[model samples]
Target chain A: MLNQLLRKLIRSASGRTQWLLAVVGLSIALLLIFAAVQVQVNYNDLLHGKTNQDSVANFLVINKLLNNQTYGNATLSAAEIDDLKKQSFTEDVGILTPSRFKASVQSYSDRFPFYTDISFESVPAQFIDVNSKDWKWDEQSAFIPMIAPNMFLDFYNFQFSFSQNLPQLTQDVVKMIVFKVNINTPNGVVSMNGRVVGFSDRITSLLVPQEFMDWANQRYSINQDTKPSRVVMRTKDPGNPQLVEYLKGHNLVTDADKTRFSKYRQIVNTVVNISWITGAVMLLFALLIFTLFIQLTVSSCKDEIELLVTLGASPKQLQRFLMKQFFPANVFIVLITLLIVTGLQYWVYSILSQQNMFVSAFTSYYTLLTALLILLVLWITNRTTIRKYVVQQQK
Target chain B: MQIRLQNVVPVPLREKILQRKSEVWNTNIVFDQGHWIKIKAPSGTGKTTFIHTLYKIRNDYSGDVWWGNQNSREVTGDALAQIRQQKLSIIFQDLRLFGELTARENIELNRVLQEPFYEGAMIDEMAEQLGVTHILRQRAGLCSYGEQQRIAIIRSLMQPFDWLLMDEPFSHLDQENTRKAAALIADECSKRKAGFILMDLDEDDHFNYFKRVEL
Candidate 1:
């Protein structure tokens, strides 16, 4: 009997204008929230360097800012290094060991007869991307393994080789080429065979083993104190705003590409923030519309509800009657929103896949969980509204 | 069930009752079980308000109303629900019927609230006796005022009530229809050995009462 009465009451109380306002507002809010979640997930992937094979780790290369007055003092001081080490984001910091000896290289291949003066810089083995065995050097070894930047080869192939009408060499071909490297140490002028082991996109300098660089620099350097001009830092979050602010405030220079990536990250963060605020506003409007609908329904049937209460009906009974009226509409709205969001997710996944971005189509389960949470909140709100109305009538 | 009102004075009627020192307004009264009573008042003297207070629907009165030993003010939610289901029933002056529902549906709401007090056929018989069986299929709002009054009377009688509180229930009914409705209520009250308080502006020969209070 109560169900019958509830059905009749619901039919009389339901208004199309209120329902349309609520549904449209809630749908917009849900869509915006879903879009925000998707954007944040993709942004996180990009920030973590998940999609690129040549992406750098959570590392940054910091160097002294060069100017006319600070050029001679550009070397990192021990005090400056200690300050960097004390940063919360800094996981590990290592100095770039500069070569203090004279080094020159001559290629043996007739296809590439080239000689150039080069400088070597060495860092910890963990920082380099090459194999440990290939990057090792000993005093008895006759050949020195070298790692050069991949950008150098790209430049030589695209600009230098194209202008000179020479055949472009692949990475495999370049690795097989041998060079005679001559180094002038304090003891004597030494000649060693050099072979390219690998190419790196992260570090820019020509890299040698730390052992070789240390031994050569100690033997050849005249100055006892040779400060480093560059530093490598492993950070917990390379995109930390505090780290960026700190670097800017100290007038330090990092890799140009890393700075560009940081800018892109900041833009993504701003977009996500704006989307969150917009979604929250939409949700607030939806809530207002929902509350308006409840108030309208309750006010329209105020006399009838009071009559029911006078006829031995409790507040809880009236709440159940109203819940039966509104609960289905709330569930339907949630279902429609979920369906639309799922379709949007699939479409976005296809678009991303077509562009060769390897992001997964499915977002985390929390999106639906959040929708369910919203539904629960709406249900609770509806119940509270009904209870308040019923209690008001009793007074 | 016995209802006790101790120095009861409704908030809105304070100036007229407490200040004027009306005899019945600030008096202690008790309506015990198995006794019919009448509260006669002039127009705008809080007749409906007094009935509402007895039904536990209004609480603005500055006094205590005890339902047996339990104060109405301190009745817990479950106890109130139980009282509404089995101990007390009311027929409002407005005959609060869902206009969208049929006449039978309004009565059936109370019938299904607890264990079946009257069989379905018995409800039809009562409707037949009250001359509303023809309009039972019609919506309560579409029915005439007299028809809606009969429906509300039948609905109140369908529930189990130790005390039936009526607020001018027969105001819209004519003599014949009012007699028919009052007979049905008295019959139900006699079967349950219950009593009722009928509030009105003037006295009528509806039932023999133990006492009458003038407000």
Candidate 2:
């Protein structure tokens, strides 16, 4: 019976049934394709959209300053610091310049008596990092722009240059050390020194100008040999957050500045809403039209059906015949529609990517799963329609 | 493949009977296989309805219709249809031949609908014996009433059905074709080991060889 049904269907497919099926099939196919195109468009837009909030950037680094602190040193030797700064591996490097200064505030009166105590001893005229463009002496006229806007004041000239330390002074005031340096790189990594400089003042612990530290150290007359605790630098591009991470992996930076970043959740949600609604709606409409068509086809053949029944057909057999007629046609249409929809989506994405509107031309798993769901729904709808028709015939 | 109709009741037009009832409104005529039983009745006296009832097409009629002693009350709708397709064939009062089919096609239709009958040679022989072989290719509607009648009878006999219910199949035929149709029907029924319930409204001499019953 199945073979017979198949032969009849093939013959009908080649005959006038083809003409009728073409119109309906094409309508359904176009509707499905339109939905698929919408899905693909929305997906590309969401994926290629502006900075997603769901994404985060992280950088991992080892603390070189902390490693040196295990030896109770607050700073590297001048030669050692120079050697390390000159290494090909360093990036966006800046030195911690320790200094001290005092400022007075009126205690809500015209005659002020109290003053804040501040102190530091040494200051590097300039800090150098081979990776940071600001410290490049080769670009003589265009030195790295100082990110600190308020380093200059009326009483102080905020200027940085290469330091030529007197060997005698370096031995006496070694205790006036800059403890820790902090670098805020674009990658969200915060590198800092592991040890604190042996100083009691709160303001000196932060990244600040050398003039402020020097005034305080001279006023206090602190004289002892000490090391700078840590040095910190910022990346050239704050948006390129990966620079700190890459530097950290090479052991050139400390681990204080590590963070994590990704945009997968945002991308996935965008895809789900965009792809599923369009495809599912198209499939739903296709199913509705298919159901209506099946009903119409069976109703139109009522006379032929009666003739077969009179020729000794049972209700069950008649139901089987109608099922056989529509099953193969449905299978063919759905498979072809799936291919067309998937292919066209890929093609449109490829075309758009060439125009720089999309980052990828590939489809996600959700698209395939959506198609499968649509097919399953169609099958279930067709079966329900068949059962309804069969019940009517029995009545 | 033997069949019997016992205690079939014929009722007024509006009276309905349930499908499973054994005894009909009121009559007894036991029919066996391989016998030509002429059911004679005046107009509107239920001759055709009785034949339909025996063939299991009239569900509202009550009776014990047995196929090889198996009560028809025990069979379901599917089983009854199966019996009609394989064990019973009917020649209607109007001939009910498909006008679109050729004479040969009409005769071959039933054979195709069921399992293959393996009696193609017999069909050709019957057509020739009934003088319809010359016009077998002609559409059945274009044939003479006598030729159409003979083809209907021959078509019904081409299958392996054990019981044949024919209702006024020769109503439009002339005297000469009527005798020929009757002879051909009796000969085919005997050869196939099938019985016939022939309903006629005429005093035809062709029904003389069969057992006669009055309703």
Candidate 3:
């Protein structure tokens, strides 16, 4: 029946009814494609919220124990690291010890949005102690200030003018960036001159590799003593709730610390919800427009319908015929819409690449959910319209 | 009329005249089956309505229209449609030839709609004998008024209908074309033994073939 209808429709192209079906079918298909993509993007953004924080949480969670005033000396020894490895749930572990130091270099004065004052007390700086000698250990150094090279150069360029020829810095700088923990001199004596590396963009406070804390104090020959403000530790089983509980039982964390962790988890849930809802809304809107397009086009041909019936066409035959004409067009329209929409999204992302635009890290479920929703909309709209008018009504 | 229509009802004023009506409020006319039945009435005297009502185009009237042995009201849409296609045909005064199609195609449309009259020879014979062969392929809307009326009559005759209902089939034709159309209809109707119920305001001597009746 459908095939016969299609043949008839092809042979009768000049009729105004055929034209309406073609146009409306194409438009609705395109709208549906756009909506599907929007939903995917919105949902994906939400899923990434939790994982993004998780990336840093593996290390950040340990700090609450070590730094809590109520629970002091919560440091883990090398033996404890070995014990963790033997646990069944353990996968891999990375222990990062970042320290800070102060140093001054000629500022290049051109990369920032605003001019800087080199005349300030210290050149804003940071230093990261990447553990491996592979040089790519710099990967672990990501989350901190010196993630990219030439960043320091860009910073100096924006803030200050370079003076005459300055001392050239060597790559050997990474190896010596950290201080020897046991090294001690007289109370007022210091060892080496401070070597500043990178600075924070959000805050004016300088960032220094944790390995350099002792070295900077001794090198500057100053008596200002300071304890580590934060100590980040990574374990193989960071997500194991039992591990967290075990650590809590060990007096490794105070009640206040547990409350803080719960608060962060709540925040993660909220961010994920926001992302899913945004995607869902975008998908719903697209589907609504798609359905409306079908309705409008179908309704436009109401005037000519009687003429069709007078031609000896059965209602079911007409619908099958319309579907044959419209279904292929709709398929083509959906594909074209997908291509155009995807291309547009790609273009937008490219433009914002420098600013990390459209970057997402999400679970697959959100995207699947959104796609299912769009399909549901199409099924409902097409079924209702086709059944109500095209498949049911007669002269 | 092999069909008999008596006390049939008229359509309502609020409705478009073309739409089929279901309720007849007034009717007081009757016709018996025959080949030369002329329905003569003044303008607005429901002459067209009488013919259309019998043809089952307007069903809303209260009346008894018998199609041979059965009540027309008892016939299904498909059955009535079959009756219109195979047993009856109509000629509008305004001549409803599809404007975009050629006169030949307009005549062919009846063949297309009726029980498959696929023989092209039939169309050729009608056009050639009616002196319209030269204009058969011209767009119907562009044909001369007399030529269009002849084509309309030819189109109605092309169908296999046993009954032909005409509404002033030669209203605007020239004297020569009028005589030609009357002769053509008379010859064809006689050969087919078909019934023709014609509605006209005045009787013309050229249509002496028809047996006239006053409304």
Candidate 4:
């Protein structure tokens, strides 16, 4: 019986054009908000170096700015390390342990022979982006696992190997080849077998495990000062502008890739923030339109509502009656908005993918969250409006 | 149940009722169960306002009205709803009917809100006695004033009540229709042993009253 009365009330009170306008406005606002949140999630994933397999570690190599003079005061001091550690963006800090002993590598193949004098450094295993069981060393081991920077291989393949007319090596092939390493210790020259375990894009140096560097430095070098000139920092947000500005202000230099990635991150953050603000403004206007629509509906139904109240209808009951008419409309609006957003997202993904960029085609979790948020707002507004109007009529 | 009215004066008609400064506005009255009472006053004498105040629908009045021990002014909204649903019912002077609904639907709306106070066939019988059975299918708004008044009377009687309040219920009805509507009301009140307070401009022979109050 109440349902019948409510239906009659809605039929008489609702203006079709006004209701359509309100729904369309709300849907557009919701669509924009959902799209913004989805884009933000995808971009955030991309900027964090997330891939299908593994994410690029948020790590940066910090060093003092170099000068023209040799032996310039470009080494990171202990005080400087403490200052970097004090930053909110810095999650963990580790120093790159420099090689104290002299080292040389030689490799011979059937078609080619290679020889080079190389510099070696090691950082804590946590700061190394490569994951390998061989990234550890012991004093009794005859072979040392090493990780070389990817850029070194790129340079070799592009410049040195091509000019020399030698065959280029893939990562798997490089990992299989062994090099004879010679270390000049205080006692004499010692030879050991070395193998490449993995490649790192974060740090540019040839890296051995910290354990091996510590032991080799103690057994070989005569110098007592073992202060490191470079530090590796793990930060929560590699793209933080404040960290970048702080580094620049202090005349500190980090890896080019780190600064480049930070710049990309800043752009992504700016886009996301702008999208969020725009979406929020649209949603606010949509809510205002919705409020006006509800006010008009209440005004049109005032007489019927007053009669119902005088006929022993409680405020809550009247609110429920009006809510029945609105709740379904809200659900329909959300569903339609989500459907439209999903289609638009696919179209956007297709456009972006054609440009050789890999962004997630859809962020289901964020989409669900957005839908839920819109529904909650609609429900609250509908209930509050009806309740307020019903209470007024009761008075 | 008994209703006690003490020193009640309608706010809008205070000066009219208290024109003589020496006159007293205070009065104590009680209507017990199964008692038929009439509140008689000409037009513009706050007759409807007095009935509304007694029904707990209007509170713009001084003093107090007590339903047994509960003050009418202090009744919570839910309590008032319950009172209207089961303890009290009213037929407004305007016959507040949903114009868009048929006469049967108007009465059914109130009938389904409460428990099964009257059987479906009983409503049909009452409609037949009140000469509204033929127009029961017609929209109440499209029906004549006299037909709508009969429908409103039937709708008000659909719910169980300890006290039924009527405001000029027979104003638009002819003598014959008024006698028939009064018979239906009296029969229902007698079945439940309920009291009724009827307000009108003049007394009539349609009901035997236990008391009369002038506002």
Each prediction's DockQ? 0.42, 0.13, 0.04, 0.52
On residues B1-215, what C-alpha lDDT tens digit does candidate 4 reach at each position? 78888888878878987773211234777778889998787787777888888887788889899998999998866677778888888999999999988899888878866676877777798899998899988898899999999999999999899999999999999988888889989989998899999989997878988887676
What's the count of clashing pairs in each model shown?
A: 0, 32, 33, 0
In what order do the candidates fall by DockQ, top score first? Answer: 4, 1, 2, 3
Q: List the residue pairs that clash in candidate 4.
A: none
lDDT of each: 0.81, 0.54, 0.52, 0.81
Which whole-number lDDT from 0 to 100 does residue B39 have in model 3?
65
Docking class of 1: acceptable
Tens digit per residue, CA lDDT, model 1, B1-215: 89998888999888877656444567888889989988887888888888888877888989789899989999845568789889998888988888888998888888876786888777799999998999999988899999999999999899888999999999999998888888888899999999999999997788888888887
| Docking class of predicted structure 2 | incorrect
Residues A165-213 of candidate 1: C-alpha lDDT, one tens digit per residue: 8789898887888889988777777888988889987688899899988
Candidate 3 residue B170 Cα shift, in angstroms, is: 1.9
* Fnat of each candidate: 0.49, 0.20, 0.00, 0.43
In model 4, the runs with Cα more than 4 Å from the true position are A9-15, A44-59, A67-71, A88-91, A99-117, A125-203, A207-227, A235-249, A258-261, A343-363, B15-25, B42-45, B98-102, B119-124, B137-142, B212-215
Give the worst 10-residue stretch by lDDT in candidate 3 chain A.
Answer: A117-126
Clashing pairs in 1: none
